[model samples]
Target chain A: MTTSTTPRVCRGIGEFRTALAERLAAVPGEASLGLVPTMGALHEGHAHLVRLAREENAVVAVSVFVNPLQFGPDEDLERYPRTLEADLELLARCGADLVFAPAVEQMYPDGEPLVRVTAGPLGAVLDGASRPGHFDGALTVVNKLLNITAPPGPVPFRAYFGEKDAQQLLLVRRMVADFDLPVTVRPVPIVRDADGLALSSRNRYLDAGQRHAALVLPATLRALAAGELDLDAARARIDAEDQVRLDYLVVVDPRTLAPVAPAPGTLALVAAHVGSTRLIDNLAL
Target chain B: MTTSTTPRVCRGIGEFRTALAERLAAVPGEASLGLVPTMGALHEGHAHLVRLAREENAVVAVSVFVNPLQFGPDEDLERYPRTLEADLELLARCGADLVFAPAVEQMYPDGEPLVRVTAGPLGAVLDGASRPGHFDGALTVVNKLLNITAPPGPVPFRAYFGEKDAQQLLLVRRMVADFDLPVTVRPVPIVRDADGLALSSRNRYLDAGQRHAALVLPATLRALAAGELDLDAARARIDAEDQVRLDYLVVVDPRTLAPVAPAPGTLALVAAHVGSTRLIDNLAL
Candidate 1:
């Protein structure tokens, strides 16, 4: 019943990999394991996901890799945050059993991977349509992580996701079902700030004025969810913001993420450039 | 090094899997393992592949599973040969270390699988075009086999195939490269009969007249290899025999299996029905 203060932290992919293998081997049997994959600039949102994983499974493996494949040539991979030491401290405090922080090269040694778990019909719409090859990268990395962490026996592994990335969660669920991978995918509720802005690592890039302007995206989405504004009107409200360069504000089916005419259960997805950083957030309506 | 008189024969997928695990565990850290996937009615062609695998790798594992996915709904699945005893004898003689004979239900308990590996450009033409979803089935089953038989550590598992199944071999090689699976694919030279007929399991279904008629397929292909035969002439030559119901006589690029202008390095493939049984053969020019 005693809590340990000192936390175990692994720096590089090789070191973490060796530790992970030993840890998995130590827990012989009857260990219910869960994985939370993330690009670790740990926030309250990530902690919420970790807490959920801890509550549901006996072991929690959180991977911190800013996957390069998911980033386009113009995207923010180089500038992506790498607070590994802080991330591990947070994970340990949040009751994570292992922190898998693999290097970019370790995850993809042969340059960019070609094995893409493409979303057949769902791919050419919403986030997929906007960011070409984004979901493919997400699914590929998830696939590798799932394979690597999957127990040697027939026991299935459980995975957790935050609802902020709703499209990613749905796509991953679809990929798992399609591939028949015996893994459980659970989605935790989105964590937001007092000002109604969804928590994101890119928030670090926003200056005072740009941060205030970024609030308009979540504000518009909240308005749509509360039925105060129509879809087009809400989109216009966000577009009116001066510092925010709107990429897309779409309403789509929650399952398929395909653009849908206003339905009862739909998702409002927002992507915009506040300053130079491109930030994305979504909410279920 | 004394050879045992009686070689072990695995009856089902579970037994074969258990046996394989035990065998692999016994030989720790030994490299150069090879796999040869086959359906159980072993012929000289299959034995040749096994022998090739034996010569190349320190350990050779052969799987005998008549994958139902590869066969069309109307094609032979039930009627296909299942000579487990004879097949094991052949494997033993060929010096295979382990023989994996899995049942249909063991392989696909949930019925038909959804994860299909398509040949993309190569898959949509020739054999792929003729037999829809055939390569998908072939690739899927091969992927499963490779995953199961892959080395426990960092070393890769090598697989052997016959050039007789030119399209299958090419598609499998494509799958290996595409997935970045830690496996080497080795294609053995095509083994032929004394009369130049490519050996196949379906040859057993041919009656005396039909068997004699089946020879025309290889003969016409050989003739086409020697000289420039127009598509129409090649078709006519393959269809010349009365007993042979010509299925398709396609000259295609060996790599992509797409139809090409009659040229050197192209593959001329023929499939015909001799009586109620269908037979296929291909020759690279």
Candidate 2:
């Protein structure tokens, strides 16, 4: 059967897993596969990731699951974007072979419970330090997805991830290694606009002026990267800005996300309020 | 392949899982299946559980894995007995369809540093209360085994467990529910000898007199079940006995494994050292 633009969709993890297995089986010898697990509201960033997977693998499975586990009780789980039909069309146009759009019930049938993947020493610092249990959710869901899509034999599978969520990517890599899952995790570069705005589905919540003000994040990160500003000074400069409400601005080691002495390979992550929308962006130094 | 008496042994979880899948596929349509996951050194207790699975399901998969995750840092991991050849022979005689003997590397290839299925309230109480990380190990390995052996499609699968370790059984059941795994957990009666000694692989460590003294566990449990003693008094009585070091004795609810106020459906469990070997036994009150 020829691939369809509006790809075949499965609603639950069980059904999706079964369907994926069956579909993958039809493809001849050792399918070179890549998975782009995401919460679907396909922006330019998501498109870049899908493109990367499409170019790299014989088959690309893009999972659009708005996992509730990762979100805190008071967070934006309820308000998170849900554009499935549009997302599928976009995925198909971007050359994704399969678009798995599972519901909240499908991803988490067991309800709101904790499945933690300990971050060791690094977990207690950086983003993990600020948001408790956040890395746990990311690791748990990623582990489930990896298990579900694991090849039947020793054949290796690669997972495509965006570097925008740097900490999440690191933790996922850790989980794959720690669990010995036969899958390689490849982190794709962050896709940004000409104005340096990192595209996010949550970006939709920004109003016209708020969207303009959001540019300060990319600007601050760029300033830090250019050696024009120190870490604390850059953070203070961003904080002193009137329009953007700074949530967190810190520099740390890119891999461990631990606070370092401003050495090379440091990641400067920033989260702030640009109007009602919370915008998060990071730059590697 | 007509069930081999010369056990078809595998060295890893992946290999074992692949072999099991192929074996299950050979079976004719929609057969009921049961799993009896175990650490090797198969005794009457494990054999009886396998026998029950054979009677219950059209296919029975008996997993023999001495899961290292369940062992604590200072625990007897190295000294734990491994008789894979003998275990398979025993299973073959017991009418088991498949003997899934996976190697330590197979089950935990990348070193399973993280565990699964933690007891929320029931954990810090009974056996969990005493052993610390014991139930976490038991639950994690059991979860992995269940996922590995879960039946395809809507029908789900059933697993048979011995009630000799009442707390372990309760924790496993909770994990199954919490994860919404499509498997029914059935706890079978504790298999015993003519002398009323609960069968265990650990019994191999006991000398003749120590083996005889081990009978006090089941004997004491039987006495409690017959209304010959109260909970605390029974524990104190067991503690007072000679030639054995008492670990713990408590009457708890069978389902929760929580200390019950002397209710009927309660289970009285005893753990003690007979010589250098630790023995545990339980009886439904």
Candidate 3:
């Protein structure tokens, strides 16, 4: 059966839940629900995720919530990209059945969450180190999205997240295991431009000159993956590049995110400010 | 249809999930599942919770885990009650459909949870102030239990907690609201003995003299609730009792748990050390 090109847009939590439930119940047997959660910049990466979900599940629900809880006081919450109309068009082409675009009030009717899912020691490193509470906010919203999309009875419920946010993907997997949440996590690889810059909504902030400087992020990861430079050499290479200010570059165990000797399955992660916009990228060594 | 008198005892997480799912699937229509979370050492109070679950839900699950995370280093982790056999017996009598009694390792296979549900400022007051991270641990385990027992599709799922642990009940309600968990929280009233002493598993630690002295806790609440004494007088009354050490006595708004003048619906909470055992009780003023 062909899914309708025009996916239903739900702005309220109760409406979305009820709509999804009705759709799932109408499935011939037990239905598998797939969720692609995004902040709604609707890039090629998001399209790839939605297409993958459409191919795998009986139904796909995409949540386009730029969660306020996940943003620091000084962060780009206001400046964060929100292109809902364009997002809906892309989701339609990608075969999404529903779009859950809740306003901040609908998602958090009770103001700030008193209880939140906290990422322990691991959350204090990398992006978390530079932007405190970033992972906590990301993980908390992801947790909420996962619960929101969960089916009433157990069939197959899976959520698709990009591997570009490697730390987030790892922490989300950890949370699912920790909470014993009944959804499976499917990781989609990092989608990059032809020039090899990893796709990010924040990439929109880059100027023509800053965009060229940001290539250092992917170049640093490629060099580390190719064994052309060691950890210190990688850091120095990014530091030497004009307009690219290195935040951190380290090779660590993918599972533990702890500094380790570069080896297969270890991940090389780098963050840099290309102009005023910060960008992060990772590569498996 | 009669539920089996001998509730299936599941020792593994996977086993319990599978067993519960299969039972739920067997229900003629959509099934409502009820959960009563406890730390074993079954008392009449637990039976009351289970019976309420029995009355309300198509299937009932009781989790008997004395979560180590909720206990502090200086507190009674080693000495906490464990009466699983008796607990199972009471559950069976109370018409519990299933008993999930996982080993610490089974519930937390990867040691302590790296990601936990934290009760914010509310967690740092009353019981939280006395025992740091206590509510955080309680909330984490409770979050896990709700997720574990959650059905695949949207069916009615509720978890029961006694009002005896007023702070815990309030925090659990908050966590459920914050997480937007699929489970409903069912609050059962505090079950007291004929003499008016609140039932507690830790009451097992009390000697005859301590047990007699523990009466001061409920008496203080009674006096405060009945307007026989104000907050200051209630503290003094509990302090004057022989062998009773006052911990804290305050009248607070039930919703916010903030200090409020004595009024109907405000909760009067009392905690004290009767000999070596610490006890807490609350009454609605």
Backbone clash pairs for candidate 1 read none
Fraction of the native A-B contacts that model 2 recovers:
0.02
TM-score of chain A of 3: 0.97
Compute the lDDT of residue B30 as modeled in candidate 2.
59
RMSD of each: 7.0, 4.8, 1.4
Candidate 3: CAPRI quality band: high
Taking all chains together, the TM-score of candidate 2 against the true structure is 0.77
For candidate 1 chain B, which ten residues in a row score worst on lDDT? B1-10
| Tens digits of per-residue lDDT for model 1, B140-192 | 78877776666543444689888888878887876665555557898887778
- TM-scores of the models, in the order given: 0.66, 0.77, 0.98
Over all chains combined, what TM-score does candidate 3 have?
Answer: 0.98
Please provide, for model 1 over A235-268, each residue's C-alpha lDDT reduced to its tens digit, 9 standing for 90 to 100.
8898899989888888888876668866568888
Across residues A197-231, which tens digit of lDDT does each residue of candidate 3 receive? Answer: 99999999999889988898899889999999888
- Better DockQ candidate (2, 3): 3
